[model samples]
Target: MSQLATRPPLILTLRMDSQSQEFFNAFRKTYFPPERNYLDAHLTLFHHLNDNDQTLATVKSIAQPAFTLKTTGMKFLGAGVAFAIESKELHNIRKELAIQLHEQLIPQDKQGYRPHITIQNKVSPEAAKQLLNELQSTFQPITITARGLDLWQYLGGPWKHHAYHALGPAPG
Candidate 1:
């Protein structure tokens, strides 16, 4: 069987509104190393979930309304940089999912949720620090809309879109 035929781990992320997505993507494209930038900007909720029908069903069961979150600050990630986000609603949603997929949660996923959208990674620490400083110099908190949950199949470095369940609507 081909490698892809076997189930791969799943990734869950929040889908942002178009404007917010574009804003993040722009920064990601401009700052991230071109060769290593496989996916667009994302706020990962669950880093890894079992790739199975049960997991899919649980994800499909989530019903959340569109909500807003704010980017409060820039986080320097040693070798990368991210925009820190704050939202009670986002936390609640992930907590609920964590409960449902408790056994399947990996250590990283089980760790405390610190929501952030990484725009630059795989660079030197010095570079990351410089970018962090540049961004923070004129940083203004941005309010962005979270529109839905998006499920993806992890394909090594790159990912393949699996499904998207819009907030404020029954799972279709």
Candidate 2:
């Protein structure tokens, strides 16, 4: 079998609303190192899932409802900065997935799951901190609707689009 066929495509992320997308997109473009900027801004859900039917099955079973993630604040990530997010429901879904994929979960995936959208990465600490300060100064409470679950194949740095499942419907 070919190497590509044997390797399970990994990397799943959460899809967000359009407004939040525009905001994060602008920030990422302006702050994130130009060289490392490849894909659009996104919030990750599960990272590094073993490529298999089981993985899809587990995702299909998630009952987590669509919700909004309030942008808590900006976090300094040593070499990057991210907009912290808080979503208990989303976390629970990820937790459930972890349990289902426990045996085959990779080391990194085994660690605690933190939901955040990185606006800047692979930059100097000074650069990160400066941007954090700038963001904090003008930061306002932004609610991004966690619309759906998106699946992707990790292509080293950039991710290739794969599949998406939107939540059924928001309670009336």
Candidate 3:
């Protein structure tokens, strides 16, 4: 059995600017199905990682230099929808961690990363489509800098936030 099967699987997220975070979160609260919405708007780096010393060590070791993130507009998620993200630097960070994790990563984390912030999910297909169109019609390119990385423990329904790994060169 995989380590994820034994312990709480860890999730990695890119910390967004406070303003943007507030906006997206409010957008989610307004649109997302209230009964199913459990977490705030976030950009997930790794969906599932095994919790261990190495995982925490590598996370804390990273000095995430702030990087520009662009929104490529909306994407249809069949029964849901999300704002697509574009960031080569973010992908590189994920790649670097993937290399370090090797076989320790969960199968889901092993796949290619398609970074996005889901604002609505598990709603009727028509509802999702309507929102996607509405958002896309009004969509303006948003450029924001990611401040750091966040590690979380997935608790069946709600998540337990662990720590935020600030980016940039560590002070000597």
The prediction achieving the highest TM-score against the true structure is: 1
TM-score of 2: 0.93
Query: Which model is ahead, 1 or 3, in terms of TM-score?
Result: 1
Tell me each candidate's TM-score: 0.94, 0.93, 0.91
lDDT tens per residue, model 2, 37-92? 99899887767887777887787787766887898989999999999999887888
* Structure candidate 1, residue pairs in collision: none
Ranked by lDDT, top first: 1, 3, 2
Best by lDDT: 1
Q: In candidate 1, what are the lDDT values of residues 1-172, reduced to their tens digit?
A: 9564488899999999999999999999999999999899999999988888778888889878788999999999999999999999999999999999999999999999999999999999999999999999989999998888899999899999998888883234
Error of 3 at 10 (Å): 0.7
Q: Is 1 or 2 the stronger prediction by TM-score?
A: 1
After TM-score superposition, what is the CA distance of residue 114 in candidate 1 from its true location, in Å? 0.1
Candidate 1 TM-score, C-alpha based: 0.94
> How far is each candidate from the true structure, as Cα RMSD in Å?
3.1, 1.7, 2.9
**Stretches of candidate 1 above 4 Å error?**
1-5, 169-172
Each prediction's whole-model lDDT (CA): 0.92, 0.84, 0.86
Q: Which stretches of candidate 2 lie over 4 Å from their true place?
A: 1-5
Q: After superposition, how far is residue 119 of candidate 3 from its true place, in Å?
A: 0.4
Q: Candidate 3 — what's its lDDT?
A: 0.86
